[model samples]
Each structure stands twice: as C-alpha cells, then as structure tokens.
Target: MYSKKVKLRFVFVIVFLILIVLTTFTVLKVLKDNVVYFKSPSEINLLSEISNKKIRVGGMVKKDSVMMNNNKINFIITDFKNELYVTFSGTVPNLFEEEKGVVAEGFLNDKKFLVADKILAKHDENYMPPEVKKSLGE
Candidate 1:
C-alpha cells in the first residue's frame, strides 16, 4: 500500500503531464490555424476541391498578362505547366511586373482563378532594392 504522500506525488505528476499535453496541443492548433500555405499554379490545378480559406500562390507572372481596369488589376501566374488568373485591387509592390516571380495571398474562386488581397514580389538573391543600391553607390 503506498503512503498518502506517494499518492499525492503521483497525482501531481499526472496533472503536470496532462497540462503539458494540453498546452502543446493548444499551441499546435493555433499555429495550424494561422499558417498560410504556399502553392504553385500546377499544385493548385491538382486540387480536387477549393476551400474558402486563404492561401498563397507563387509563380512567374506571365508576360503580357497584366492588365489594369479602374481600380482592379488582373494578371496571370504560371508555373510553366499551369496558369492561374489573379485579380487584385490594391497597389502592387515596385518589384511586381510581368515575367517576375510573385506570390499572391488570397482566396481561390476556382482552380483557375484567385482573388488576391495582397501581392508580394519575389526576387533573386542577386537583386537589390534601388534605395540600397543608391545608398551603397553601386
């Protein structure tokens, strides 16, 4: 028969383990909810169903596919194997241009189209911002 002190210690250890497990699970769940996955045009095309959740689609902006109408801008992102049409109604970054790598954060209306709330231009490692270049006198 274990003493009262031993039983109390066992209960304390069990409670501590349960608390740790619950905290870990809670943190994981919050992280999962906040994570925004990035996908290419080809990967998006392979999706069986489109969800209302937000996602990021990254690829090269197809040449001659950028068009502006009023406050909206439309462009096509292609991964060589597939293309996704994107519509955005905000000022794009200076680096955003045709034939450049870009990532659009938004919701997908279908496999072929995305309604972007934000646009992020991606550049190669060799690229530098104009301000930095000027400051560095390069």
Candidate 2:
C-alpha cells in the first residue's frame, strides 16, 4: 500500500510539471508570431515561399548600386555570393552608401526585391551587426 504523503507528492509534481509545460508552450507560441528572422541574399533565394511578413536582410551594398530618383532610393545588397535589390522611399541614414554594410528591414517582393521600411547602416568601417558579419563572412 502506498503512503498518503507519497501520493500527494506525486500529484504535486505532476501539477507543477503541467503548469511549467503550459507556460512554455504559451510563451513559445507568442514569440513565434512576433519573431522576424534576418536573412542574407543567398538565404532569401533558397526560400521556396515568400510572404509579406516583416523581416530583415543584411549584407554589403554592392558597389555603384545606389541610385536616387526624387525622394526614393534603390540599391543592391550582396553577400559576395549572391545579391538582392532593395528599394526604399524613406529617408536613409547618413552612413548609408555603396559597398558598406547595411541591414534592410521590410518585406520581400517575390524574393527578387525588398521594399524596405527601414535601412540601418553601419556606424563605422569596423562595425557591423554580428548576424550580418556572419552572413557576409567578413
């Protein structure tokens, strides 16, 4: 025959575990909807399905790729191995320029181009986001 104390302890442990599991599940589900992953041009190319979800793409602005048309700017981002075109109508950071590290936050248009809502440029020659550096391998 099992003692009452042991049965009570087992029930308590089960309830505690269930509570922990439920909390973890809820947190993960909430984060899943909010999470936006950063990708490079090459990674974007491999994606089979493109969505309008907000995301970030980081890499170097290809040399001589920057162009201006009235208030709009267009550029190409490259990971050396692959490249992606990006267009933005907003004011760009002063540090933004060709052949510099930049991260564009926006939605991809059929994986061929990114319509950026924000453009983040590197602070200096030596600074780059770790995610972007890893993607560029430099």
Candidate 3:
C-alpha cells in the first residue's frame, strides 16, 4: 500500500534508470562499430578464419617485397616470422620503403592479403619525403 506521491516518485526513478541504461547501450554499440583492431602479420596468419572486416596491420615492409604494376602497388609486410601481402592503389606515403615500419588499413581478401585503403609509413628522425628530396635534389 503506497501513497500517491510515493508511487509517482518511484515511477519517475524507474523511467530515469531505463533511459540511462538505453543511452549507455546505444553509445557502446556505436563505438563498437567504429573500433578497429591493430594486428601484426604473424598474428593474422595464425587466425583460424580470415575476416573481411576492416583492420590495421602493422609491421616492417619486407626486403625486396615491394613491386609496382601500372598504378597499383603491392608489398609484403613481415614480422620476420610471417608475411602478409598488401595491395594499395593510391599514392603511398613518402617514407614507405622496404625494411621500414608501416601500417595499412584495409579489408582482408581470400588469400589473407590486405586490400589497403590507406598506407601509413613510420620513419625515424632525419627522414625526408621523396618529393622533398627531389625538389632539394638530394
């Protein structure tokens, strides 16, 4: 047996709690869709199943693994234990080179290869873009 005012307050609190829970759930669901996991070539190669979801793969570009055909660029990322091939059509970063650190964002294909949408190159201090080097003639 609850009084009228007490029942109204209880109902208000329940509604507020439900709204908070719904809002929290919605935010987490949205964040989950945007989350991308970063993995190395060795880790990817060991997966039981290949996924087509977008992901970030980071490793050193293998020596003598870079090749260009027409406008497309193909390279192999290696963790020294395993290799993951990557295909990118757009212009690559200036520091992208064999034996250098690179991260590619893209989808995995049937051959466990990455079809890169973007390529990011990591370099040390004293690094220069090819365009800059060309303009400076060095």
Candidate No. with top lDDT:
1
TM-score list, all predictions? 0.66, 0.64, 0.61
Clashing pairs in 1: none
lDDT of each: 0.93, 0.88, 0.87
Model 1: how far is 136 from its true place, Å?
22
For model 3, name the residue pairs that clash: none
Show model 1 residue runs off by greater than 4 Å.
1-37, 128-138
Instruction: Tally clashes: model 2.
Output: 0
lDDT of 1 by residue, 1-138 (tens): 999999999999999999999999898888973554578999899888999989899999999999999999999999999999999998999999899999999999999999999999998777688899899986
Model 3 quality (TM-score):
0.61
If candidate 1 were superposed on the true structure by all CA atoms, what would the RMSD be?
Answer: 6.2
For residues 36-105, what per-residue lDDT tens digits would candidate 3 score against the true structure? 4468887787778877678889899999999999999999998898889999998998889999999999
By TM-score, the candidates rank as: 1, 2, 3
